[model samples]
Target chain A: MKFGVFYEISVPRPWDAEKEKTVYDNCLEQVRLADELGFDYVWAVEHHFLEEYSHCPAPEIFLTACAMQTNNIRVGHGIVVCVPEINHPVRIAERAAVLDLVSGGRLEFGTGRSATWTELGGFGADPDVTKETWDEIVRAVPKMWTQERYAHDGVCFQMPSRAVLPKPYQKPHPPMWVAVTSPGTDVDAAERGMGALGLTFGNMAEQEKKVANYHRIIQSCDPVGEFVNEQVATVNFLYCHEDQAQGIATGQRLAQTFGYMAAQLVSAREAYPSRSYASFGLLPQARRQATAPGEQPGVPEGLCIGDPERIIQALKGWESTGTTGVNFLLNVIETIPQEEVLASLRLFGEEVMPQFKEAPDANIRNARA
Target chain B: MPIYGTLALEEYAGAAPVTGELANEEWETDQAEALTLSYEIDDTYRLEMLPAALHPSIPLYAQIMVRSHGSSPVGAFNLAEVRLMTRAGSHYGGYTIGAFANTTESVEFLRTRYGWAVSLGDIALNQRHFGARAHVEVDGRCVLDMSIVHPQPITPGDFLVIAGFHLARVGSDLRLIQSEPSYEIEMIQRGKPRLTSIDTEAFGDVRVRPQNPIVATYLKGSFKLGRVRYLIDPTRPATEGTEQI
Candidate 1:
């Protein structure tokens, strides 16, 4: 299966003026290294006001930097929050097109409604209507990119007929995806004919069921973009080393730190109960896996967080789930040193990546073809 | 790094009376009806309300619950509590700020057995044609008056209630006891929350100014207070200090 690096750009507290800058520089260096190592894509998230968890409020700016610095790696907005107050549809279409043009068409446009009240409430957006707003925005953006001019009087926003300019570098526009966090979101993606971008770390059986449901439902799907992006990519943590124990120990620190920080944020369902948010987003799962009394947290099954052979076995299990790719979180709060992270990436690239034969963008190519 | 709570453990421990044993037995309740109202509070005081072992929840909020027990070992009683949402390490739970019960026996049972910060109060939970309401009074002053207006029927599964964290003096040590109650819900309803009155000072913290009303729920359920499975040292991070009981 194809592999990619995902970034939340977590910056720990007691921030000096240069801490965030150093983190960004280190991430860019990682991206450059990944590109050279034959990694396929680099994804970044859009989050807000989440201290010590995610400082990446502007992923477009970050992804654009990634695209400019790398030649072959595709830059992905792991998601742009589809709420109007956070991002107007036309602006989203316009910015995405510009990025696609600048990146030489190497853009995977992912979309979702922000799942936390820390972000949604900050924007004064209504939690009850985010689902409707996301549906409207996703539909309207594809049309905006394809048509000569677009206009709509929709529930979320009204726009007079105007050319949403700078059409994308990709022929029918870049592939579309939805961030699937809660249960049944994979179905939502499949029905819209978008890629299912799995954000939660479920077991192999759970993932297999979700992938099965997605494939079953997409046969008669209506495409949201020019063609259906019939693909599934799940998220995992990666920290490969020659020594299995050392790699696992470091990886556990990364995982636990990430889980700890994630729990500190307020999810939409926790703060505001609504039918729009079906589950408590991703925080509770992370919280459940946090450190308990007198016991060390064990590595989750099928996680890519060990030596080359172990990671290879884990990825094979994921491949059996019918997933197209794996997007890995490489670090959290800079818990692993930068040099170690780079070495881990290099080792994974040299040892683990060669074991898989599928082209990184094979699904996208086939869908377009 | 997660933000730790800044409440002084020594001062808090000194104020609390040593009651429950370190090893306590589990307790269960009969059929119960509860009215829960939650509201977003001023986050400036979030950290101050919790001990060092905990972390303030993002978008700081508080829950006011008034529950009426149909039958218990201490006979029938009405209970009310104010809890600040917090994170014990990574688990989401509420930290008890103040608790009031209608009966002396219930108060004594809760305080001496579970280390609840409970006192005697006049409390009532009533159901109206429109919805449900709860009123709590202490020292002849109305401390809480909240309601669920025009509550609409909702699936029992939709109501997500978190666990409660009580600071108790357990066998000469001040520990943060985890009180998780499992509810077998029979019926549940949701409605717009209305806070008619609240004395923030009377609840032990004037900084708990309710800014936005989140939700109100009324549920008929049989709940069992499970055995205390964990405790946390109030002076250290929960990750480094939690102990299995």
Candidate 2:
């Protein structure tokens, strides 16, 4: 499986002027190191009003910075909220095209409707209509990227026929993906011929079921973009050390800190009853993962936290599930010191990554061919 | 570390009266009907209302639930409550702002046992042809009037009701007691929420204004309010302060 670095950019409270700046600087430094380490992608999330949990409201700007600082790593604007109140489709298409152009056509476009009331309510966007709006935006954005002039009168937006400028450097546009959190969303991604960006932290058995269903359904998919971007990438936390015990103890801090912050946010399904938000998006799983030290018997199954050998064993299980890639979150609220984080990255690159290097992009190349 | 609540411990202690003793026995109720209306509230006072042990929910919201119990330990009664969504450490739940019950027996029993900030009030929950309506009056003045509109049938599992945290003086210390109840839902329906009137100050805060109606649900079920399993110190982070009963 391919490897990638994912960032939530968590900033702890009592913020001094330098806190946010320092966090961003550390992230860019990590991104630069990952590029040299042969990491395949750098992914950043778009979250607003989630203080301490995520300070990254503008991922496009962060990805642009990553693209500027790195040479080989692909830039993934993993998800731009498809709500019009937050972003107009024309603007999303335009910004993505520029990022692709600047990055030499290394972009993976991920899309989703915002899941938290903290964000959707902050923007006065109706949760009931977000699904419909996302559907409209995803279908339209590709047309904007491919068609010389795109126009539409839809439920969420309306525009006169006009040329959408700066068509992407890639022949057909960058790969498109859907953020899959709720159950059955993998099928939604598969039906639309988009990549399934798995966001929930589930066990190997659960992931195996989702990946099998996704590969099965996509055989008859109708492409939402110019081509079928068939891939599955899941998220996990990483902290590798020479000593297995020390690595797990430290990684527990990173995981617990993130889970604690996540529990404080009100998901759309929790605050509002909507058929649209079928499950409590990602909060419950995150909270469960954030167990206090010694609360759990051992590292939960499938977590990439331990010595390099242990992480390799866990990842082989993920590979057996047919997922194309795994994205690792490095830290939360600076819980792990910078030097250790960098060392972990280097260790992972040197010892763990080489084990699964063969045919990393075989699926993508096949889809394109 | 998580963000700690900013509301002073003394202020939280003074918000409600001290209870008698922690109730050890679980209480069960017969067939019940409930109407729940939830709305997003202004988050400006998010930190000012909860004690140091809890974390305010992002984009703070509140739930107003009115229920009619067919039979209970205190006999049949109607109860109405207002709760601010919050988190105790990594657990998601609600912090009681205010509560009211139609019968004085329920008000006394719940307040002394579970630490609910309950007082006597006039409350009614009625099922209509279009949907369900709930209203509460304190001293003959309307405090809450809300309804569910265009009801559509839904599965019993689709609706989730979180637990509650009540601040009461347990012994000499102010504690946030957890009251988690399990429900066996027989029928449930989801619908658009409509609020005709609400006196926010009556629920103890003017900042609890409802900006947007999220959703309304009406269900028929039976519930068991279990014995208190945990207590938290109001002056520290829940991770460090929570204790098992």
Candidate 3:
């Protein structure tokens, strides 16, 4: 499977004055390394007010930095919070087009509504209207790129029809995607005719079932834009080393830390409990419980968190399951020294990626040049 | 190409300090023991149940009853606290809206000591393996008879956070006090609070008539006060209260 690096830009607590710098610098360096090592994309997440779990609030800024430093690697907004409160639709349309122009058309516009009350309430967004707001912004952004003037009478945006320029360098618009963490969101993404960036697929069997369903549904989905991006890019942890023991050890440590940090950010019910939180936990309870407590927190069975040979074998199952690409989250928790993370990327490039380079169907990607 | 380079990203210089236990496996904190059952009421209810003194952006009322086992100033207490979701231009935590405590000790300790608007009441907090029930009566009038069943177990990844907020008082001048305590809690469950009854006349304009209560369970907790940040000191003049934020 095709692989790319992902960043939540996780910084552990007990912050120093230089914490932001250390995290951003390491992240930019990773993007540059990924570009040189023949990686596909450097996907960045947009999250707000989540202490340590995600220090990245402004992903466009980070992705711009990624584009400036990398030549070959595609810079992705794995999501821009698709609500007017976090970001306005017009501004999102403008900034995305600008990034596309700057990055030489290497942009994958993934969108999503903010999940936590800390984020939604912080931005004063109505939790009830978040999904509809996401739908409007995601649909309208493409029209902003192709049309001379864009306007909507909807309450979310009351723009007087005006030229929404300068258009993206890509002919129609960049490929659109949605961050799918909920169980049926793969189907939802397909229905909306967007790429399914599955954030919480637990196992190969589940992924196989979901991916098959996603493809089947997308064939008949009414497109939200001119073109539909039918692809499944599943999120997974990646650590490769000559020694299998070392790889799994480092991988599981960071994986567990990531899970713990993610859990802490899962909206505190005592703070802002609501009925809208039914689908908050993406991975099923039964699936998560199967990993046994002592093993790493989110290391589901048969993931790409091992040595070159092990990772290669594991990916074979994923590819057979109809997976298009794997978003390899390369860093977290600040425990893995920056240099060691760099080394992990280099090793994956050298040993694992080459095995799939010659595969007949790598990915029929939206990387339209 | 260089148009966006001129802009600076939003950054927080510092944050309210909390234990990093939930984030890292190596991170550890002293566990506190308390039993709490809370309910989520409507925001309009905050206009009455929550003190207007807090000037909360949004109000959350919980029919919280507690059995302080460790580090909690001894004894059992129930508080129908209307908490502000945010205040003073930051989300440090929720503040005491309006509170009622069963024991005289808890009422005075929380009110006179911490500036909470705690009053005396008759209350019960019953917690079982499967579910919990909380009942309250203020001024010899039954106020709350709520129960929450079929608790959904909370996984460690989604941990319970400390309830942090400012306590406002209007006696002898307007006083706003940020309480000095950090809570360390373990084990939590989520369920809906079934409200049997609520009378707003007894609690002032608080019309908290909800069919479904956002019920929650938190247990095994301790609290220790860290450095307290004072926006308004009771000893200070009234002018100081509004200027602090």
Each model's DockQ score: 0.52, 0.47, 0.04
Model 2 Cα lDDT, one tens digit per residue, B143-230: 9999999998877766777889898888888888888877799989888889998887887666677877777899998978888878
Candidate 3, superposed: residue stretches over 4 Å from native: A268-276, A281-287, A290-298, A358-369, B1-245
lDDT of each: 0.85, 0.85, 0.64
lDDT of 1 by residue, B34-151 (tens): 9998888988867877898888887788998899988776888999988998887777888888788999998887777667788899998999998999999988899999999989
Task: For model 3, state the Cα shift of residue A337 in Å.
Answer: 1.0
| Candidate 2 residue lDDT tens string, A159-188 | 999999899988788999998887777998
| Error of model 2, residue B222, in angstroms | 2.4
Chain B TM-score, one value per candidate, order as shown: 0.95, 0.96, 0.62
Per-residue lDDT, model 3, residue A82, is: 90
Between which residue pairs do clashes occur in model 3?
A263-B157, B32-B220, B32-B221, B32-B222, B33-B221, B193-B213
lDDT of 1 by residue, A258-300 (tens): 7777777778877666777877676545545544532333346
Name the better of 1 and 2 by DockQ: 1
For residue A146, model 2's alpha carbon misses the true position, in angstroms, by 1.3
Per-model TM against the reference: 0.95, 0.94, 0.64
Winning model by TM-score: 1
lDDT of 2: 0.85
Docking verdict class for candidate 1: medium
